[model samples]
Each structure stands twice: as structure tokens, then as C-alpha cells.
Target: MAKYLIKSDATIKAAKPKPAPYRLFDGDGLYLLIRPDGKKWWRLDYTIAGKRKTISIGVYPSTGLSLARDKAKGARALVAANTDPSDARKAAKVKQAEANEAERRVAEGIPLENSFEAVARAWYAKKSSSWVPSHGDKIIRRLERDLFPWLGARPIGEIKPPEILAAVRRIEARGAIETAHRALTNCGQVFRFAVAEGHIESDPTRDLRGALEPVKGGHMAAITEPAKVAELLRAIDAYRGSLIVRCALQLAPLVFVRPGELRKAEWAHIDLDAKEWRFTVTKTDTGHIVPLAPRAVEILREVQALTGRGRYVFPSARTSERPMSDNAILAAMRRMGIAKEEMTGHGFRAMARTILDEVLHFDAHLIEHQLAHAVKDPNGRAYNRTAHLEQRHLMMRLWAGYLETIKAGANVVPLHGRAAA
Candidate 1:
């Protein structure tokens, strides 16, 4: 409330350094406060919203008395003209803070030639929410274990095929040609994602055909023998690693959906009363309906006993809320003495295909539809639930019963049937 203009001697006497709140006038509404803690603070007192407001320009030693006076005079002029100095001060502070924030963000966005780890992290932050957690972890694990030491720090945009080939070739040197290919493919995807984000001009992984050795092709080993299929089922029933995966294993042959589709099942997708499991297959454009067999439904219900209230049906034992990784079934296969070349995650479909067509003679159209393959014919595209629906439901139940019979150590032939296996 004190007004301006105290002489130097009067100011010195006021600022004599004591533990008390006192003010010195500086030729306007501004004043310097000597806080009891021996700190100097400048205050310009005013009013707004029917309330007294004080704006602190700064501390005196840091924001000297002359400058404090100039700030007070400017604020006083605004007040006399019916402007609120407090709101103006707040607005200016906000502008300064916004400027600082913009500077920080711009600096953070400046792309550098980062290591594989850095780019992987940036890509992850941008894309992780869309991906399953296990998928995100696998991406980083592959980069760290396979590519980081060799090429992690190389700028992604500057990465050439030879550098990529060299990194992949390191894994190949350890005699894992498939792993070498997988590493290259994973890196290619990361590069593509980087390109989408304007981190690179083009993908360096586009034409690495000659760089990494091409895979030798023949025929994939499949469980073609009925006796062998029975043996495999028996082995699966006897698995000891995880009970949830065991249920998945038992359900695999019955439903015979893609291993990934089955493994990553969420709780909301099932309709037990309707005998359907609805899920989208991203590999194929259309949403798929898996007609659950009585056995498949039974397994799902049993799985739900432990996980129904949770987010994912086949939730990872490591964590709830997310489905088990796609590898969960394949790993169970390994424990059951099934070789990778003999069978794989997707090989469950192939396994069912061979048995259903060669052995049981179910219609090919039903099998294809059940596999969720794209049917290009416009009429086929507009398929009713009646067309492949009855056949698929029948095929699934028959397959389920056949598995149950084999699992029970009984010699069984798959039959189009009406009851639960």
C-alpha cells in the first residue's frame, strides 16, 4: 500500500537486513521487500476480481531496483488504464513456458544416427500400443541379441544392405540360417516403420535377396500318417509345462485355427451359447468366425474358470490381461517331442488339412473357409452361414471327437457326428 520514491539512505535503513517483512518504494507502485529470511523480492501490488493481487518481478540482487521500478511503472500504467497486471503477467509467463516447451520438443525430435537400440525404442514408443506386449518384447530382443552389437548405432536411414547382410550373416555364421532370415526380416520391418515416420527416405531392406542366402525349399514335414497324428495327440495330452497351454494343445487339433489366432484369444470374443469364437484375422481382410467344437468349447469354458474375469482367455502365465504368446503352443509342441520341421504353430492347420481331406473326405470348401482364406468370387464373398457354416461346424466336431478318441488311447475314425466328442 506504500507509494514510490524513498531516498538511498531511507532504502538502506529499510533494507538493513533483519528477519522481518518490510518494503521500499521505487518511484511508482513498485517496492522491494526484505523478507525475514534475508531474501530480496520485488512486488507490484494491484487488484482484480475484487481481490488484491501482487506480481513479483524478481529478486532484487538478480532483478535490481532500477529494473524493478521500470516493471512496476509499466504495470501501474496498465492498471490505471483498467488492465489487470496480474492476468498480463500470467499470460506472459504462459507464453514463455510454451516457448520453452516447443524448444524441448523440437530438440527431442531431431533425428540422429542412433544405434539400433535407440531407433528400436523410438519405434516402439510410436507403435507399441498397437502391438501385443510379447511382440514388442520380441522385436527388441531380436535387435539386442542379434543386431545391436553389430549395427545398433548405425543411422537407420543410412543403413545399406551390406551392413544389414553383415549383421544377419553373423547369426548365419552360428548356423541358424532361418534365424538369420528372421533377423533380416525383423530389421526390414523396423526400417520400414522408420521410413513411415520420416526417419528415412527409403527402406534399405527392400532388395536384400542376394545378400542373405535364400531358403532351400522342398516340402515341409507334416503329420501325414494317422497313426503318427494319434501318437502326437497322446504326447500333447501328457505335456507337463503349463496346464493352460495343455488346454491350448488339446484345443489346437479340435478347432485347428491358426496357432496365433488361438493363442491370443481374448475373453470378449467367445459366445458359448452360440458355439462361436469371433475374431479378426489381420493376415486376411475379413473377420473370421471359428465354429467351436463341443470339445473346443469345453476347453474354453475350463480355461475361463481360471481366466474368465481377466482380459485374455489364454492369458500369459507371466502376466494376466494379455494372451499367451503365439510361441506358447509351439513350445508345448517341442515338449511333446514334435520336431519344428515336422510341425509348427501354423502347421496345426496343415496337420488338420491333411487329415480332414486325405483321411475323412470333408468338403474342401468347408476346410478353406474354416482356414479363413480369402474367397475371391463375389458370390463366395457374400456367403451365408448355411453354406460352409454347417459343414464347418460338422468338420470341427468330427475333428474334435477324433482328437478326444486318440487322446483317450482309443482307435478312432473322424465321422460327421451330432454329439460332443
Candidate 2:
């Protein structure tokens, strides 16, 4: 078919509107529609799927005769190819919109919606609330430090198993084998979340099982022997550091709470008259009652003279507004000639757990409850914080007395019914 029958721009310019809408046919289903209201439009009429359709090419003069014919030719090509021009136009519009959206996301420093970082952040936001604050902090820090720098910008669907393995391998290369494993697990979660959200087909990390080095399991170093325990108690007594940290060191074995719990202890949580310290356990988000032994109360009373007005019982040496530093106890122990393998801040818990059961012969359940562990009932239900408060109170007193005996260089034999005595 011969096209561009409208030879001159002047011919189109001189064509005026008639009393009613009429067409100036330009051949091959292209026409100039002259409206009675003095308006002219370029139109392309086509047939596809045995149905006739019309599409607007442009306005009359602004889209010149040449441009309108070009548009008409493109639409006719689609019809000949068995494709609908209208559908093609709509698809182009959607593609352009997606490009614009991607540009906007990049400009704002936001990840594309299907990018690994984007999905990982969404997953973190949804799940972090259920975790303890410190735990949640660790997870995000792991992603940012280990994974985000490497794999964050990639589309979650396009991330392969090797890319993920390579990212975590950097962490392993730094000797953080455990952290590398954790980073891989976090990536797997984000990938699974993307899959559930329809962004990816499968978790690539699934193919990476057994790819990294296994973490060696070990317990915190602790002084559980009675003689070493006595030596540690005497070393703490002679620690001429800040009075607050000294009291913390003194109370550690008596209460035997986690190092974090001990460092973050608050004055408001203590009831010295009742000989108990009550606070929420950060690890489990459950309430715990520490039956403060008489000796533990004595240490608190001494520290109270200095820090009773502050928020934390063991306030920072440099700033009372915050709790003591996490390293305060460790640093103090290091200064006292205690090796890391000999004892640690967390070792106090293991020390108490072992000695209380083996030497003191306290009931295992009561000791577990005192240790703020998840002690379950006979029916497999978890026991509440105050399950064995009375017995635990007696056990704490006996334990405190036993410590004093050992600290005084006495060969204290562990006797049953010592609590009654």
C-alpha cells in the first residue's frame, strides 16, 4: 500500500473543519478527523483478531502529517504481526513507569523493592520486635557488617548460591566462623522471606549447607573447684579498683546472674529489706527474682553509699547516666592476673551451676530456677520465675555461708541440711 498520500504540510494546514465531523482519508486506514467544533485529530484505524479498532496518533498540527503517518505505520506493523497495538502501548507505559520508580528508589538511597537489602530490612522490621533488644541489634549489625556490603544491592531472585557463599566466606576468612554461619543463616531467612513474598523462587543458601567450617562448641571458662573459687574470692576482695566494680565482683558469684544482667542492674529493682533483686531477664524476656544472699545484700549496701542515687547500681566509672561497660568486669579480672581461660565474667554462672549441684547438693530444679534458666514443670510447661522462692532463699544463704567459710581458708565440708543449720 502506498503511504504518505498527504504530500504537503500546507495541504493539512489549509484543511478546515466542516459543519459536522468528517474524515480526510490519508489511505491505509489513516485519516484526519475534522470536527464541527473546529478541532482536528490524527487517527489510525486497524483490524486485529477480526475486530476493528481506532487509536489516537496525535493532535493535528503539533503532530505533523509526517509524524502521524509514522505512528500509523508502526501501529499497522503490529496488526500485521498478530499483536494488538493498544496492548503494546499499555505494556510500554508500564515499562516506563517501572523505570521511573526504580530511578526514584535509587535517588532516595532506598533499595529496589525486590533487592536483597530491601527484603531483608522488611523481614527484620517484621521480626525484630519479638527479639530482645540486644539480640535484634546483633542481627542487624551482622547484616550490615557481613552481608549488606556485599550482596545487598542484588535482586533477591538473581542471587545465586556461590555469591552468598563468597560473601560469608569473607567473614570466615576473618576467623569469625560462628559469625559467618550466623550471617549465612540470616541471608537464608531473607531469601525465604523473598520467596514467600513472591520475589524469588528458592533459598540459595539451602544449596550452601555444609559449605562453611563448623563452629567448635565450648563452655565459658569458669573456676568451679572449691580451692580456685576461694582464691578468686580472695582476689576480688583485694581488688583495689573503683568501689562500684569491686562490689560488682563481690556480688557476681553470690547472685550468679549473667554478666550483662549484673552490669545493668538498677537500684529500683533491688529490695534490700526483702533480700531480693527483681528484674526482667533480657535473654528470655521473662521476670526473674534473685534471692540476694545476706552477703550479696551486704555488698549492695556498701555500694549503695556511693551509687544509690543513680539509675544503675553499677554505673559507668566515667558516666553515671549509663550502666557499667560490658568490659568492666573482664578488665578488672585481667588486671588481677586472671587469665581468660581461667575465668570470665560469664563463668560465674557456670561456677554456680556446677558447685550448687555437685558440692552444695541443692535440688537441680531449684538451682536451675535460681539460674534464671527455662525450668519446665512435670507436665512440660515452663515454671514461672518465683517457682521455688522460699527454698532458693535458703539455698542462697547456705551458699553464701559456704563461700565465707572457704574464703577464710577453712576446709568446709559440704553437708546436706546445711540450709537448716
Candidate 3:
């Protein structure tokens, strides 16, 4: 028989709480502690490094006899290995907590390498710094609105081409054909990024080529002929609309920016004395300088007298707090009998691009730089937004003068690398 102070369950059951607490030792540092209040607990007493300590195993009869002995045995093993049993128990609890957390994460569908939302968000964080605020918002919106519902929790490594195709087709079904194409391209970029990072074996988008409808590319309608451009200029001068709308129409051909950029022009961005309009280009997220010609500057100065106290140079008719509607210029053109097939507000950009390069014979690179068309230098470096400022300043003035001549119905005259006379 094992040596013990109390050897039988009958003896423990027959004992009752007394006026003081006492122990019934089973053996080898294990005992039953009975309190004056009738509570009994299991405990282990041991000595380490010349000091004595105690560890609570549990309360009984909840702990039971055989289970208490097993716990005591495990604690003794720790003490024999020169580890404090209390410290060992604490370490086990910490380890168990970590295991529980990992299991919960698995049950919640989180993983180490394959979550599409995880990888996509990482990629967005890496790239959003170089993009405009609006552009970044659009990227996140595209994923949340169109892709996340279907594939966010799916593993990037396990996502096949069929899943990607289905997500894109759903967007196409909503009549967002252009958005569908853009979403697929974005997916391709993300998949390629994952492959390069070794998170996936290959891009699933590679197998999806030619599965979408081919986009038919067409140019924005513009009056490219010299006579037709002259007529358009004449019509703009004769437009009897709101003062702000007429002014915007007159300035459109001179600056020839995208319609949104022109309409959203703020008084804060223009400097009349400096003869410059400096603002961030919405499409590229880079600073762009529109060197104001005398004619363009005059138009701005006039509009400032009316709207200088407000934020936008062209405030909407409904409220001065907002910029004019994007369709303001286009609607004005229609009212003037310039059909949509003949011209649009965006047509000014094409008109200037064609006339500057083909009619006036200016350097194509100079014209492209002025158009903010992402031109590269001879060294293949991206041109700074302010690059070629001197050339652009002279080009704006000459272009304005050429428009005046065309408005006068003169023959197609080339500037011939000289200032317009």
C-alpha cells in the first residue's frame, strides 16, 4: 500500500468541519484541506531552492479523488525538473489561451496566406499613397460594391478563373460594361501582385482573356476642320445664356481641359496677377499649371468680380456653395444648335490637340505636355507637371491668337515656329 496519512474515502466522509482548519495528507505533498466553514480543497505543498510553497489543485468533491491524484502527479513532475509548479501551471494556462485564440480565428474563416480581402487590402495600402484621394476611394468602393460579396473570404490561391468571371459578369449584367472591364483589370493587377509576392502560384486572370466583350474605342466628337471650328467659335461668342455659362464656353477652347476640370475650377486655384491657374489634375493626382493667356485671364478676372467671395469660380445656378453642373457647357451647346454628334464639352480638348499639332505645326511633345497627357522625356523619365512651363506659356498665347484668326474666317495659317502675328 502507498504510504498516506488518510487512507480511506470512508474516513474523509466521516470527518466534519471543526472550530479550526486542518489537513488530511494523502502522500507526497498532496493533502485535503478542510476549512472551519465546511469547504474542502485539494492542495500540494513542496520545497524548492530552500523555500516552501503551496499550489491549489482544485476544490473537491468537484475535483474528485482520482482526478486530484493525477493533477498532483503532474505538478510533482514539474517540481522535480527544477520548475516551480505554480509557474508551470501559469505557463500552461497561457499556452491554452493562445491555442483557443488560434482555433477561434480558424472558425471565423481567417487564414495566413489565401484570403482575397486580406491580400487585396494589403495591395491597396501599398499603392494608395501614389493615387488621389478620390481615386483611392473609387478602388475601395469597387471591391466592396462588386467583388467582396462573392470572393472576399475566398483564398487567393484557390480562386479559379470561373469565380472571377462570374463576379465580372454580374457587374456586366447591371449595364456597367465599362466598370466590368475596369474591375477585371484591377483583379488582374491584384493577382499579378500576389503571384510576384509568392502568395499564389499564378494569376487566374491570365486564363480569362477574350472572355469579355471587346470594347469599341471611339474619339470624342469635335469640330476638327478649320471652317467648322471657326463656326463653333462664332457660335460660342453669340451664346446668350447665363453670364457664367457664356464665360465657361469662351474659356473652354482656350484652355481645352477636361469638362470636369473646367467646371470645378475654384477661385482659390487661380492667380490673376501671376497669370496662372494651378490645381491638382483629378485624373493623375499631380499638380498641373495652366499658364493663363491674356484672353483667358481676362475672362477669369471678369467672372471673379461676380463670384470672388465663393469657392468656385463658376458657382451653380441653384447654389453658390457648389460648382456648376458638369453638363452645363454641353447643354449650352445643344441650345445653340450644335448637335451632340458634332461637338461635346470634351470636344475642346480634341479640337486643340488636332489644330496645335496638324495646323500650327507645334512640337507634338510640347502640345502633349501642355495637355497633361503623361508625356515622357528623352531619358524616359515622367515629365514633371510643371515641366516645359516656358514652352507652354508661349503655346497658350499663340493658340489663343490662332483661335482669334479662325473666328475671323481667315485661311488656315500656320504659326511656323514663330509667335502668332
Best by TM-score: 2
Tens digits of per-residue lDDT for model 1 on 1-421? 5554656534645566665677776644567777778887888777655777788878867776667777878888888788898878789889898667656645886323344556767777887776656667877788779997788756676778888888899998987787788888888778877778778778888888667766653124557677778788788768887778888887877777776678778878889999998888755445788888887888888878988898888889899966787678877787777888787766678888877776777766677778887544455455533456766787787788776776677776554533221
* Model 1 residue 80 CA deviation in Å: 62
Best by lDDT: 2
Residue pairs clashing in model 3 are none
Clashing pairs in 1: 5-27, 115-152, 115-153, 116-152
**Residues 9-29, model 3: lDDT tens digits:** 666776699898888889889
Report model 3's TM-score to 2 decimal places.
0.64
User: Which residues of candidate 3, in runs, are more than 4 Å off?
Assistant: 1-145, 170-176, 189-203, 206-211, 339-342, 415-421
lDDT of 3: 0.86
**Reference-based lDDT, residue 43, model 2:** 91
**Model 2 local distance difference test score:** 0.89
Clashing pairs in 2: none
